[model samples]
Target: MEHDTSLITTIAAGFGLALILGFIAERLKIPALVGYLLAGIAMGPSTPGFVADVDIASQLSEIGVMLLMFGVGLHFSLDDLLAVKRIALPGAVVQMGLATGLGMLIASWWGWDFGTGLVFGLSLSCASTVVLLKALESRGILETMNGRIAVGWLVVEDLATVLILVLLPSFAGILGGTVAPTEETVPLWRTIGQTLLEVSAFIALMLIGGRRILPWLLWQVASIGSRELFTLSVIAAAISVAYSAAALFNVSFALGAFFAGMVMRESEFSHRAAQESLPLRDAFSVLFFVSVGMLFDPQILMEKPMHVLSVVAIIIVGKSIAAMGLVLTFRYPLNTALVVAASLAQIGEFSFILAGLGMSLGLLSSEGMDLVLAGALISIALNPFVFAAVNPIINWVLQRSELARRLEHREDPFAELPLTTERKYLEGQVVLVGYGRVGRRIARELDKRKIPYVVAEQNRELVEDLRKKGVAAVSGNAADPAVLIQAHIAGAAMLVIATPETLNVRQIAEIARTLNSDIEIVLRTHSEDESQFLQKEKIGTVFFGEEELAKGMTNHILQRFAP
Candidate 1:
């Protein structure tokens, strides 16, 4: 009369523990991911409680990895990557090299062979995409220049890790590791060529064919008027492409799903697709973090305390210093350098994959894997703190060091607009903040009406383009007093903020009001809470996107009924 309850028990334990711990973590002002990992630890074999099937958990985690990468691809902007390539590409490479070197040195000192050291080093080189995205999104900066740079940097690291994963087995002999007899032995150049060809073919196929086919498939599903079917199609597409990539091209699920999302993003229904698939993506992402926790053996913390410490130092300190130095050397602002540094100060899924692979190849020992897990656990738990410390630490350093102050205050000529001789353009004009999707539309309307307005945009390139078009534009955060002054906010008739930056909207409004008390202010926000708060405070004329959309739809329906 008894039923096989293994799957149900595993699901119940995972979801139940994760929900409790995630809520606690949120209450404690830590990221819910930390809680999810803790839940995994609690239910893991490493702990005393119920042990979920490690094999099942691992498989679930693969789905999590695929979905997480797919979500990242949905938001991936080629323009953003190109915007930060001058720094992100080289900076990521250099930072990873430095971090890897630190790991290798530590491993060598521990008497591990060259192969173990190399594997250990490689595992520590990349940051967790999930952690980075969560941090950036919480801060409402995922669309900012700093966020774009961090994302681009992670993308570079991901690509590098993928290449390493592909090449590792071929080098097992030289690395003092044993490869499976079934493993194909090819010349190094041939392996490299083959890998590149496969990747190129996949990319080409996705970009050319998948872009058209996937969207068409989604459209067909939607036309059937079944929400369940649409969601199923999106999930099926993600998993199917991921499986095919691994089965046919020898590509990782992460890369395959990323390409799928990227191609899907080209469709007009991208937003709808993202919204529909978000719940599944988030659930799997949680499972991914939980599975990571299951691999962690707390015994390593006590047994090899110094080794764990050394790894954590490399992840948090060594990597951060390397990234900050590279960013500053590139003449980016101190804020940007600190943000990028904080973002890279943790490792996650890729580290686990590398460590497992290394162990399977007899390159990394169980002890080494434990150490990597220990470091990942600690570093991830501390990542939110690291991000929280960025501004305060920068302020503290600037306060004590004259050089630091100078660096913070230094302005990049390329990022700032030159003052114009004509004062008429500034006086009695509307000051528009941001130059993104919404701002662009607003600017177009303003331009067509021949309204005198100046744009204050953070994207220097966008500002440059505006200037080229004979429009008055200033390049800087509108929240900054100097930028507002440059934009002539004091004399502006109206101020419009066309970005969903709820974090700084209040400050920007305050600064604008102080500069021109009579200036009419309009602000856009995606959050109902923010809109209500702004309105309650009399901050400005706040527009909630969803509310406006609802109102527009209601009005259209009412008109139809009236006719």
Candidate 2:
């Protein structure tokens, strides 16, 4: 009369232990995922306690990946992704290559064959999207420029990994893995072609068809006025689209769910959907870490501690250095370089998947998989500490090293405006800080009215494009008085702080006031507390985002009825 309840038991045990350990971890000043992963390791088969169903746990983890990625999609705009392409695209590609090379070199030293080493190298190359999203959100930087760059870099790496996933199976035979059946032996070139075609088709379908259909579906469901149904619709869209993409087009579940969220972002109710999906994402993300811990064999640590150490070095130190160099080469600020470096000092879900796949295809040995898993566990657990150390590390280096200061203040061609700038732009023009969405709109209006403006933006590529268009722009943070002076702020009639709230508005205001006491200052902020602080300081005319939005909507309603 009784049936096995393995699924129920797994959930109960996973959650119960996760909460206790998670609490303990937080109290110890560590990320709670460290606790969740510890909970999994305890319940794993290797530890000889109560081992949960690996199969069920894995499925639950997959759901976590879907939800977490979908949540990111809700906040992440396509424009954000495109905006960082200049740095993210090349930075990811080069960093991955360097990481992969380091991995392969170490593997070869351990007597691994080329096929095994290649798989081993690849497994070390990519960082976890799940870990990154959670880290950024917790730190309240998910919408910041650094966060955008990190997310965009990971997205590009994920795309490249997907391609490798496709082509890896096809090249298994050639790479010294199991050969394909004689009847199904398609040429490598055709496999490459088909894989690209399929990936492209999937992207096109999501961008064109998914974008149009998803928002309409949300509207239809919202009109019904049922909260539960709206939540159900969002969850269904995330899981279903992710499942379908993997089933029909060979895209990764994370990518598919990400697209689903991006499309859902088009709906007016996106904030609601993100809130509704929050609990599930948080709970299942804990389960995801637990499952990852389950895959790790504790013996691997004892047996091949040095190999594990080597792999960790490549992931945490080697890859991070490579990424930092690449970013600095692109002329980003020193702090941006440090943050991104710290961001990538770890590996996660994709590494496990890649190692597992390689094992199945006979391209990797048990030792290889064990090594990758060990590196992942250690690096992921240590990633939070790495992030926490960024500011301290920067300060430590700057205090000790003259070269570091020089690099931080290095000259970029676009850092100064051209000598050909008209006098109108130099004197009594708008000194706009940040050339992002709001600033662009203001610049467009100024252009129409023939009011000259000099833009100060941190992104050098944006400045380059602006200059190419014959617009006056300087490439550096306006927080520096030198950057402001480069923009000729002394002669400017107004200082418009249209940047993200990451800047120290007070410092900028003081700098502008000192440079030109008559200049009017304007500012924008995302936080109510900060807005009040700024207003109290009388730093400028503060525009709190949500307050302004509410006022605009309220005024529109009033106007609609008055006429």
Q: Which candidate is the best by lDDT?
A: 2
Predict model 2's lDDT versus the native.
Answer: 0.86
Q: List the residue pairs that clash in candidate 1.
A: none
Ten residues in sequence with the least summed lDDT for candidate 1? 412-421
Candidate 1 TM-score, true structure as reference: 0.88
Error in Å for residue 326 of model 1: 2.5
Q: Model 1, 1-563: lDDT tens per residue?
A: 99977767877888889999999988977778778988888988989968998888888888998898788778777877766677889999999899989999999898988889999999999998878988999887898878888999998898788678766766776788885655446556776677778888888889889999998998888889999898888889999999999899978787899888888898887898899999999998888878878877888888879889999999999999999999888777788889999999999878887887788788988888888888887898899899999989898998899888877766766344466536766788888898888988998998898888888887665666677888788877787898888887888999999975667888998899899999999999888888888899998888899999999999999999995
Number of clashing pairs per prediction, in order: 0, 0
- The ten-residue window of minimal lDDT in model 2 covers 179-188
lDDT of each candidate versus the true structure: 0.85, 0.86
